[model samples]
Target: MSTFGTLYRVTTYGESHCASVGAIIDGCPPGLELSAADIQTQLSRRRPGQSNLTTPRDEKDLVQLQSGVEQGVTLGTPIGLLVRNEDQRPKDYTETDLYPRPSHADYTYLEKYGVKASSGGGRSSARETIGRVAAGAIAETYLKRAYGIEIVAFVSSVGKIHLPSSIAPPSAVPVNGADDNDDVEDSLSPEFRKLLATISRAEVDKYTTRCPHPETSERMTKRIIRAKDAQDSIGGTVTCVIRNVPAGLGEPVFDKFEAKLGHAMLSIPATKAFEIGSGFRGTEVPGSKHNDAFVRKADGRLGTATNWSGGVQGGITNGEDIYFRVGFKSPATISQAQETAQYDGTPGSLAARGRHDPCVVPRAVPIVEAMAALVVMDELLIQNARKTAAALLPAITTLPPTMVLPKGKQ
Candidate 1:
């Protein structure tokens, strides 16, 4: 389960309190330029102690490239990466011995594996994502170089404090006591579409909340600070967009593009929900109103007048920007006292002691971008392999015009 992707495989390792955490990336194309600094940029963004809103645990999160490169160029071999855990405080997790840590993975991991790490959340910790980010950076570099692909993610909401672009009209009165939002607002509002088209990482990082909008980012900062002051936690959503993707990527049925994306996003620690395009809102809108209308793009390729489908049609990329949102639950390792059952089924009060984030969406932005890159990269390679293999075969001129693509049309 540690590994992901088919051709561009990535396997991550290490625990929260371990000496080091990293990933091994296999199947990267040879001769691509790479360096530790490139990977470090994203790692730094994801590291703890970025601001008052996040955990106070200070980690440099410095990256070291161990293999698969020579003279700053990838060798097309398995790329090994490592980031040492310098500021680990295993003693802070002493309460975990008595309690499973409410809403945490401590219980489930032990139940499934029959044993769990003695300190921290082990593989369930966000530290495990170090390798993913590293591998994704490589995939991103390749994607950008090969297709000018651009991926950007940012905080869209913190608890109830949502960006104006993300706000939707209130739900209509329940019909027959059924809950539905038939008064659905346009998921791809003109303002939101413009933001997706132009927002950059630099603009997002300017504010600690990473919301981009000045007013909403300030409110989100206050919201996170309030939770930290109360020794509680909050949940939020992250939205990501990928642009300049060519049409016709993704497998049908089993490995649909969005399905793989959901798998990757939900795999991150604290993630609770995943939605693409119109998401849940689409359910309420009539099919005629929700459908994306085809239009001719300036590049002579087909596009949608309305992107309610979020750039994907029939589970594949459609040459439009692919966008989605990921929801992260409140962090479970808060320093709050709670009455709960212990591992042995005894009643006890646990006041957990550990430096943890009050809200995770700001730091989760890069993880979202990284996972998106991996899915796109893997699907791109698969599609490319199929195209390459099909090119070698004799032309099928006997097929009906409706059944086969016309020559030079592709």
Candidate 2:
């Protein structure tokens, strides 16, 4: 059951301290440009030792494209990718054979599997997510090219240190600045101008940390420093928004859109909660105040005045920005010692013995975005295939006159 999605199936493999870890993506359409470089961009973001706020595990997360792609395009085959584990320290967890870390899956893994890889959390390790992120980047590229869909995620909060409302807009999109030297600078397309304006309003590049706001980034950095020094960890929420998603992307009944997204989010290490539009807050509001009002746009497109449904209705996308939030628990391996039990059920005091993060929300931002992109792209492909099949039905039943003449000539 490691595989996910009915259309775009993704199967992840390998362990945290194993020789390598990777994913195999099936159902990718042929002719889409793909390369290892595309996947690396995302792996670099989730790679450990990237910053002071995250774990200090220094691995170069270099990806190897194994199959499915030829030259630069997909061959309609399963795409295989691998990321080697260069800086593995399995010895750190060798003691786990006796002392199982509290609040970790060590005890449960042993009980369920009867046998488990003791070093690192094995399959349960966050390292396994590298494959997921890599595969997701490829899916994202296809989604963007085919549908102009975009996904962006950012750290909204870290523990009690929250960003100001004015700093980060809830659903701001990222944009690249225009170059003054370009001859086409003055003749910018309307789309480019709109993108620039959005970027300017979002202020995404104002901070070196890629945070949407400068003051918020500074405050978040300070909070991470404080938490590290106190030998504790902090957790927070990540918000993701997918724009321009087409309608009728998800299947009804068992395979709902939100359910697929939930499966992906919960797969991330430390992720504890998932919520869609309105979510828990909707319960507090009356039905009238919570419901979205449908309206027609100037372009004759259907739109919603309010997005309480989170751009999804009847378990399918409704051609709106799909927005959701995921909650991550603090890193379990903190420096502070706590009372716990050994594998033998004896009393013991345990202090985490490896390099770990004071906060994981910042790094998790990209992971969340990657998962959302993967799901949306899969759904897009499914919808497109269905449409193509329906359009070909009449043509398949009868040959065209042009085809008959050509056959006789041949």
Candidate 3:
């Protein structure tokens, strides 16, 4: 579905080669400060042509806020945002009219709709996600203000060039006297854990690759450049951490928090897999090693000695940092010649043309962060409504099962 989220719903419109692309965000709470600059920051990160490894197409991706805000404050109405397509090259895709690009959405779209957009695969294009990132930034901004939630995502790997073992831990390991959460986790100092684990956008944006570690980011960049030189693409992983989320944010069974998170991440263009907490690695360890022991925190709340659960258990937030990884497949469009059949099932040789990312993780970072924010924001509203209802349960107990108290009393 083009629309996402329950309470904080978003409906995206337009296509990659269309005149403009954007999203309409509904259910946004009012009275928060918002502006075009706030959404542009993330859109710039998700925009094309920012680095040597990504597409050469340079798009300003300047967002225009059409409605739902007045005097820089949201009005609790549907927010409409748009970004014009100033650099789209529909002619660059004239060749694909003959045969569907391998591993792309061309064939499936044509099969499903009996016709498909002739340029950039239409809705299949990464360009379509521009609206998502914009809407996500809004959700993230609200989350930060309302709950002090911080969502940071970075490229963890590119092709075979994984970050060194010294750096590739699933959790954010702040260093020095900074936010290294390692030591504070096992003790009663949950306050210290919060202090040490905070990561700012400045740190994440320091490198073009978005990997905070200088040495590892260089390797990832080189790997992407190498793939571009070979006319092939490489796949990689993106890790996102959401911190300062209080407990009880997801529903049981169907709307489990992590399940919704996975749904959001997989909806991205090239994302192939999603994992949270220890993910598959926990299977390699014994039960004793994998389990997170509980402790009484300095704030008089139950805290985990370790966060192997990645801040969530039973699909709900546990007040720990929620960290997860998303695996993106190599870009399907490349310049290398390949043997393929046309729509008529006849043999053909094709060399795909046009700009595409040699590695998508760097650009995917913000997109992942955006999706994560949307999920959490929706769950937060649901949980808040639950709290509102639970608070009134006692007063309504004497009424009939289907009845509700009068407005003034409630």
Candidate closest to the true structure, highest TM-score: 1
Model 2: per-residue Cα lDDT at residue 192: 25
Q: Please write out the lDDT profile of model 1 over residues 1-410, one tens digit for every residue.
A: 89999999999999999999999999998989999887888888898999998888889999999999999999999999999999999998888888899988999999999998988889999889988998898999999998999999998889998887444211211123236535444566667778889989999999999988899899999999999999999999898989999999889888988889999999988999998887876667789778888989888878898888888889888988888889899998877789999999999998888788999899999999999999999999899898878777777889898888655544
Candidate 1 residue runs with Cα over 4 Å from true position? 165-185, 407-410
| lDDT, model 3 | 0.85
Candidate 3 segments exceeding 4 Å error: 170-196, 395-410
> Which pairs clash inside model 3?
174-180, 179-196
Off by over 4 Å in 2: 165-211, 392-410
TM per prediction:
0.95, 0.85, 0.90
Q: How far off is residue 280 in model 2, in Å?
A: 1.3
Candidate 2 residue 367 C-alpha distance from true site, Å? 1.1
The clash count for each model shown is: 0, 0, 2
lDDT of each candidate versus the true structure:
0.87, 0.76, 0.85
Best model number under lDDT: 1
Q: Could you tell me which 10 consecutive residues in candidate 1 have the lowest summed lDDT?
A: 168-177
* lDDT for each residue of candidate 2 in 1-410, tens digit (9 for 90 to 100): 67876778889998889999999999888999988888888888888888777788999899999999999899989999898888888888876888778777788889898998968888888888887898789988888788787887767667765545333222222222453322211112344223323532135334424456567778878888888999988888776777888778787776678877888898899999898766765554456666678999777878876676777888898876677778889888787888888877889888877778888887787789888977887777777787776665444427767554232121
TM-score ranking, best first? 1, 3, 2
